[model samples]
Target: MRIPVLAAVLATAASLCSAVPANAAAVWEPCDPAPLQCTSVAVPLDHARPHGAQVSLRVSRLPAGRPADRRGTLVLIPSGPGNTGVARPVTLNLPPEVRDVYDVVSFDPRGLGGSTLASCELSLADLGGLNPWPAPDGGISANVATARRVAAACAGNGGDLVRSISSRTEVDDLDRIRAALGERRISYWGISYGAYVGAAYATRYPGRTDRVVLDSLGDPDPDRLARGWLANTAVGAEDRFADFARWAVAQGMAPDAAAARELFLSAAARLDRSPREWVTGNTLREALRGLNTDAGLPRLGQLVRVASGGPLPAPPQPPPAAALQNLAAVATATICNDVAWPRPVEDYRRGVADNRARYPLTAGMPANITPCAFWPYPPHQPIRITDRGPSNVLLVQNLRDQATPYAGALRMREALGRRAVLVSVDAGGHGSYRSSGNACGDAAVTRYLLTGTRPATDVLCR
Candidate 1:
């Protein structure tokens, strides 16, 4: 999936919160609308060298409405390696109960939002190269060239700060934030990629976490890391497409679900042979992977109809060039710096061929090689998630998430073992709690968050 970069900048503060010691008093100022406070914490550029060069990370908080009822702090970790959480405190539609009990907090990781920005200064073409979509004929020559070019650009342009972006550094930064807040222990609500971060934090500092929630978790296997997550998308896309096909059939796009699948495959193959306007086989495949949610069904159906000789839809407005570049730089640095990807182009060639034959909807894009394969530096020590933490963690996942998927969530659950309980929702989408509209799942999560209670065993919500 192509992750979008959120570059929202809060209004300038009358006075900035200068960096202070982790235990020093936190100086929060009114940076956004009323009731939202912002601050910056100075963290070492490299966690290992605590006395060396440092960078500041912007943090935001929405104080609890009833301070007397305050339980503790709740940190909302952002999703993408490129996504920022500083604005989430005011932007997310958090439940009133949650807002009343705990102070909601979020932050821009080292290389995002109002923290310290990092860029590769890559051209728009190179930024697009970050996604390894194979050619129409399932060839990898173009992909290989783009991957090498993007990797070289990042290594040359992105400085030490960019190279320092990884889950391990992020966990260190989070502990500093916790210390800055003066909270002996903190609760967490992390989604998507943030789930991995949260898992790593819980594993590293199990004693510091009170109540933890991991939503839409990916595989926590250290050996594969992001590589395994990417490859698993092939299965995720095929599973989610079944839901889309049923929706298309109900919308009268085809006589039945099987016909809808046939129509989509045929249209994609036709576009591969001859492009229609800006629509190509790879573009359509990416669109399907993105539009797997119920809310996205209508737009996806329209795209399919257009591909089947209907009128073309208006093109989407592009994001700012700088935003795109920052996203590509940070995502590439994080994924590549987190683990070692296979370097042989032949590995991707064979994998893509097999993936395309097995899952035509994705067209082998998920298995295709990325800039990570050609990254300049080797990965640092990896964080291994195990069942060594407290039993304070809770996991919520959708049955069919096109990005993280159910299979990966199962792996996470298995890894966590007795330390966590799984709340699986029988649904087709990306997120579950407070997103999929599954009341059962929502109640279980909310109850756990409020009362610190969890299911004795894994529970399925339908």
Candidate 2:
């Protein structure tokens, strides 16, 4: 899975079963799931150069809560084709059905948590400024320079570890992880970008998979891969914005169906010249950039309200330093490693111009060039997303997700063909299994995970 970088961007439980003895000091460990143990698994730094070197991946397992007779290993592949979430074993509180029947497993991919790390050493400012959201007039100058700087930084600091972070390598490592755990067939629960990692694994190691649940999918088209993922933000943004708009109107923007868009833009334009003083040099547009983030879901109309004829919403405080950097690094590496981006600054300029003209709501953030454009290395292998896997896949999507839009999810649905079933949540948010808004959608996914039973046809939970 790729770390969601602005661009950096579940649960359940049951178990009175005496708390399993926990790993001490645990800082995080290399562990194997089942036999209900934790241990380290090592993979070559560069697989092709086997004896060259190696890195440890943290792995862990939480056993099933049901019939003592084990079913299969169910790995909760964490997001970020690059965040070391190997600690998931200790973090998640899953349903008893999940714990008792299958060994719930997950690992920090090679070179990730508990494993070695590759850092760009980006300063906090650079991290905050990576996802160039153009100026109100849609400027791209600063964004372009930042992109190159980031690319160069990665090239300089990434080291040998960067070379091994590919989707294929990850699948291979997963296989090795499964082997080390002594499981022949494993099941998967992948959310967001985890869906990509899971799909790649199933495609490469079909016989090794039993049941799979992919949530918030991106288009599997390789060439257009992350670009597709990036662009979907516009769709996602628009979808949520519309929701916000409707809510705004409902809140008396006008005649039930408010058309107070002019007011919002007027406020933005007003702030463009005289930005509100939430912080130094950061204006309303810049503040809105925070809203453009993953958690800045569309329902923010509650915050986007106009005051004194100005749409000056109170901005939230920025996140912590370490939290921001690690997340940012993971997203940048995953995106950069996965594919090469458009290089011609002119291409990005034109793309941004076009996108701004077409989808002013996203302000050209999606179409604008990223560090991927100047990535130091090309993708290890061409992206290949075939519908050749088994038919045991289940996809659950929300009609409107701020990060992975419904349209992209549809493309994934098409890519999988008969190999998958889709469940659409009738809500507007990114968290699919349970957004706290769609119980039906949540129940459907939970059912599939617990019983391996899926709907005959794609169903919309309204």
Candidate 3:
């Protein structure tokens, strides 16, 4: 999710290998031909009933370059509730300072990749056709039926993997991984949904955490959870779009910021009515949501320009059904398990209409019905991030994050109380650490993780 500068600490660090028990052997073998060492740790399906049943989690580790100076294992919690973490070592480009002092570790959660299989078996066509954005007129009758069908598919096919998946279970799995590695305490670098998991772990086992970095945090509302995250997408998009508009204006896409917004809105509305080309209203909204920085502004502007009233492109090919089925299976399980969503058809209709009116940029996706509405089971109580933990947390957030906005992060910041020191970067994008390219923000995170030097109060990195 987010990175560097402690040669002195590396040279003076004590070997933590002695803390591990001789009998607690974690046999880590290279994952294929990659540099990552892979292993599996067994944990109970349900933490409440530890003696009932068990499941094995696939864990991967990027060993510290200087094993003699390795202080502890640094766990990288992947972004999605559905995203695979075992492949994280390949994607994660850590600074030498961080890689030298800590063995980077990550794992796939219960229902994702190598660990376990849970397929919803949804039709490829249905998955592609199912847009969270309802009809332009805000009619949700078809959307409601689609939501019901998807949920039914998941209920029938997801099986025990869906039933056992929850934030609580995952956190417990993380602790088990720590024990398996023979580390008394572990450090964390969690982004987006991963940040929520990290907060849950820190609150539950504050004493067992050495240093925690909650990057691009989500709202930790006890009742809302992912729902809150979904709902905030509209606000985040609007905030981020302003930055994009400025970039577009500079790139000569529009005369002004207002013109850029107007062009995008009008073009999106036109596509909603008569969609002749490959680009549709949903496509535009998704592009807006996904454009995390200025680098994406020109392409987004071009897409909007061509889709407004220009020539059509070739018809796009539909993705394979198996892939969507896997993603839906895990994502639905996670969202449905984290919290309960509104169940009635009217609730969705009203939400879509209201959201569409209030935030035209996001259309109605944020408030529209998901598989959670028809989930067979109720959610386990969502965990609340509290000040009951150690003050070992460092939060690095961008002011205008599309996925996790500054406002939502403020709630997490407030919830953590004195346990965290926030490094607020004056930027407009998502994931504020190394990826932001803001030296001030990156340096703060690297310094905290490497040297354990955090500001006594929150610092604004501009």
Candidate 4:
């Protein structure tokens, strides 16, 4: 039975003395006075200390057009550990069948958008000045100092709430949202980092999970977690770069794929030795990331052509300080909180050495050190993903995703075992479902979401 609003308030008052009512029926109001509705969800700051403090998550809903066909709500989890979800439905590519039967819901994770906010209070210089990519020479001497200082800044300004932003913490928050909605079970559609969150939620609360879909799956290695994700990018980028090289040759930008690859590598090295316009080592890496997709390849080709020979182009404008600060704070907090990275400087040094030798295209950036190595607070142990939960998961992956490659997703697929059915799309890029151009992959996901059907065996979308 739904608790009365007054009873909900009294229950919350008894527990946390917070004004937020416990599991109160959401008082939905028009977000734009259109069809979209919005509300705030109150959850504990620390699930371990439920009565201590609280935070509010901004939640939005696009109610199903055909109520008669509506089966349940489908929550869309955004990609970045720092990406806000509350505004995602506006741009999400939802199939008509799925949209007709589900109220699409999303929320801004803690420390983001309308939620209880925290910032690292970092300077714009520090935000843009620091590069996640290590030196092209593979010397991480400067990176060590920067990682330490950045970690310290986050800890100093982020407060306790930042320390608690993690996949496990987010699972608790998800459950709280489910409870607040008065739903017995909730469907989930999570992409990239959100896939890890969805997996953790299913592992922790399998009974409450329904029609779960994990797109662009991340490595589920508990000990390594984000460390593995960062390192795997070297291989992922090399695989995706081949596609771009082929595209460049076909577009007449280069004589052939091999020549194109060599030219790109030379350009990266030249930029590293003497910065030209916006073509610094960091920007080169960022440009390659964009080059992984069809939609982005044309722009990448233009950049490459100019870089080969031309006047130095102007540096692109950096993001506003506030946006950068928020992103740095949230991304740093989430990864650092999930698990500790190896603290020894020599470990990263050795790893970078190996990566540079093995994957020159990536230039060892994937194995480089990050602020997580210097995070002050001890992190919770990561959840070991296994085939112990309900068999209700659908994994959609691209063959060559730059951020979450096929190799890493294979581990996730193996770990899920009988618990999931995977649709391996023969495509290149980070995401698969609606983003991948393959009709087979899109149809598979849409069919699964609409009818709860799974192939008897894993299928490759060709």
- Which has the greatest TM-score? 1
Q: Return the lDDT, model 1, position 63.
A: 93
State the lDDT of candidate 4 residue by residue for 1-462, as single tens digits: 433322332344345422233377776778842567888888887888877667777788888879998999899986788888887766788887788899889888887776666577666656764556777688888788778888888777677667878888888898888887778899989999999999988888989999999999889999888888888888788889878888888888779888988888877787788776666755777777655457888666656665657655555676666666667778888889989888899999998899889988788888888888888999876778889878999999999888898998999999888999999999999888889889999998888899999777899999
For candidate 4, the 10 contiguous residues with the lowest summed lDDT are 1-10
**CA displacement after TM-score superposition, residue 68 of candidate 2 (Å):** 0.8
What range of 10 consecutive residues in model 3 has the weakest lDDT sum?
Answer: 1-10
RMSD of 3: 8.2
- Scored by lDDT, model 4 comes in at 0.81
Greater TM-score among 1 and 4 belongs to: 1
Model 2 agreement with the true structure over 180-282: per-residue lDDT tens digits: 6777788888877889888888787778888988887887887877778888787776675655556557667544433555555555555555545552222
Model 2 stretches astray by more than 4 angstroms? 1-37, 67-69, 87-93, 253-260, 279-299, 306-320
Show the lowest summed lDDT stretch of 10 residues, model 2: 4-13
TM-score of 3: 0.91
Q: What is residue 225's positional error in candidate 4, in angstroms?
A: 0.6
Per-candidate TM-score against the hidden true structure: 0.95, 0.83, 0.91, 0.93
Q: Candidate 1's residue-wise lDDT over 227-332, tens digit each?
A: 9888988888887888888888787888887898899898888888877888877667778778546898877776777666877878777668767777777788
Ranking by lDDT: 1, 4, 3, 2
Model 3, 1-462: lDDT tens digits are: 000012211221222232222226688888943888888766666778765555666788899989999888899997877777997866776788899989999998866665655576677655765557787787777777777888887777666656778887788888988998888999989988899999999999999999899999889998999889999998899889888788778878789989989888987888787775578777778888887766777667766876656655454465455555556777778888888888887888888888988998988888998778888888987788899977899999998888898999999999999999999998888787878888998998999999999987898988
